[model samples]
Target chain A: MLIFIGLGLNDEKDITQRGIEAAKKSEEIFVELYTSPMPNINIQRLEDTIGKKIRVLSREDLEEKSKTLLELARRCVVAILTPGDPMVATTHLALRLQAEQMGIKTRVIHGPSIVSAAPSFAGLHVYRFGPPTTIPHPSPSYRPTSFYNTITQNQARGLHTLLLLDVNHEKKCYMTIPQAIEQLLEIDKEKILENRILVGIARVGSNKPELR
Target chain B: MLIFIGLGLNDEKDITQRGIEAAKKSEEIFVELYTSPMPNINIQRLEDTIGKKIRVLSREDLEEKSKTLLELARRCVVAILTPGDPMVATTHLALRLQAEQMGIKTRVIHGPSIVSAAPSFAGLHVYRFGPPTTIPHPSPSYRPTSFYNTITQNQARGLHTLLLLDVNHEKKCYMTIPQAIEQLLEIDKEKILENRILVGIARVGSNKPELR
Candidate 1:
């Protein structure tokens, strides 16, 4: 059986009891660190807390050599763990679809996700906020202009946008609050007509999470 | 202080380990029924699983007579149990704001919510979903044409709308799949929409959930 477990958001304890149980029972555990990472915890802490030695998989290992993971799932109970909710990234969905084609039974264990937690913890109405937008790190050579456009459109309609910053999991590069604010300010500089109150959320699913 | 604990989507076991621990220590535990309900488990079963006596609070009790709940929070650790993630509702946010005004410390323990669970279970990309729209039950005297307008607008922008069925906690009325479909068809009345695929998910966060 192929099971996808979300490590929730912040720390080892952020994982649900059901998710932890599935990870413990799995014959092989694989943690995908490409998408996102728990801000307050690391692989060693997760292994100690989960009581399982989890093999880490990079983006290339999962996407390029995915046959190895699928082959393992064909016979044993393989648990694929991702930060936050699994299937948020298209790569994970591709993996699940591939597993299904191989006649492997698949199951997903839901975990606490920032999509809902962001609005809830920030004291914002879930329904009032519009669709969320991701903000990647800006560079002089290449800036994620598409993300800026999405946030601008959402703001035009008087909707709040949950901006997910870009993260480089291999280098462990996470977009911090100051960097996100700087990127937004830079976009606002080119487009002077936009003015919207942006909310910054960090360490979601943790006690006393930083919210502004 | 009043601590809002989301019971997650399905059964009592879906509650996080932290939520269960908090419930065990709380002097009074109240479950708000108006916002949402755990479909797989009832009040009694939840009480039995959590090993605590729970009181179901109506919308009136929460909105009009919250003083009792507030007072209980001041005396001991009071848990306000909610289905799905707590503070997903506007009233809960208002309650939290009120608690702040009264000098009561509040803490929100995040839980699994449908906003993230739906896309994960449906195999849809989380970033692809636009602003979700709720389809309310049409009234005899009032025909809601705006619901269709929202759906059309969302489609025009290449965004999928999450059709949340109406929840009538006062009458124990849950808008099911068939009922919601009928309402949408009645509102739109378009021939091209009959074959449009719509995913139905129920009992999320359980070991075994239904997906159609």
Candidate 2:
């Protein structure tokens, strides 16, 4: 069996008991933390809690068909853990599809995700929120405003948008709220529209998440 | 202090370890099962798992400014547990806002929600899901098709719509997939939209969640 365990938003303890149990039963366990940054994740602490050693998988490893992992899963129970909900990243979903196509059974140990947690913490109705968009780190050749378009459309419909901050794990940079605001403001000035109601949440799913 | 603990999707074990810890520290813990139905929920097993006595609350108790609950929260730590992630409903958000207005601190111990999980299980992108809408049981006095509108809009944008199956706890009626499909097909004929791809997930967050 192949199990996808979500480590949730914060540290090691954020994983559900069911997730832990699933991880404990796995012959091989892999963790990918690059998708979303868990500010308080401790490898040692997590290993201690789960009583199993977890090898970290890079984005490339997962994107390259996850051959070895799938092979292991086909032979024995294997688990792949990820930040927030395990299958949030497209690559993971693709991997699951591949595993299923290979006739390997897969299971998901659900975990707390910022996808739903953020709106709740902000005391906003989740249903009123439209499709979520992520603000990318704009380079000279690749500047995008689709995220801004989403916000504007949602605003017209009297809906809220969950604007995700871009995370570049390769650069070890997690986009700060101020950086996202600066980027959005730059887009606003470029588009000549000033209407914006943005809620900046920092370190959500932590014990003391700062929200403003 | 008031804390909202989510019981997650299927059963009591779906609640995270953090949520369990939060409940254990609470002076008073309340469970509101009317919002969403947890088919496998066993109050005895849940209470034993959390090691606390949980008092069940009616929908009215939570909707009516949460008078008694908030009163106790002001004096000591109190928790309100609900199926899936707490705060998905507007009433929970209102209650949290009211608690904050009354100078009571509030915290959310996030749980697994179908909002994100369903997309993952279906191998669909969570970000591609537009505004979610619930299909309600049509009554003689009220027959609404707003949910169909949501799906059509999402389909136009090449996005997916998370159609929530309505649960009228008072009537002990949970909308089955076939019932929702029949309802949607009726609306599809009325709206003249031939494009539709609906994925139904049952018993998610359980040991066995059937998806099709």
Top-scoring candidate (lDDT): 2
TM-score of each: 0.92, 0.95
Q: Taking chain A by itself, what TM-score does each prediction score?
A: 0.90, 0.95
- Which pairs of residues have clashing backbones in candidate 2? none
Residue B140, model 1: Cα distance from true site in angstroms: 1.0
Give the Cα RMSD of candidate 2: 1.7
Please count the clashing residue pairs in each candidate, in the order shown: 0, 0
Tens-digit lDDT track for model 2 on B101-160? 999999988888888888777788777888888999988898898988887777777778
Error of 1 at B195 (Å): 5.3
Restricted to chain B, the TM-score per model reads: 0.89, 0.95
DockQ class, candidate 2 = medium
lDDT of 2 by residue, A45-152 (tens): 889988989899998888875897888889999999998888778877888889999999999888888898898878887778888999998889999999998888
Off by over 4 Å in 2: A189-193, B189-191
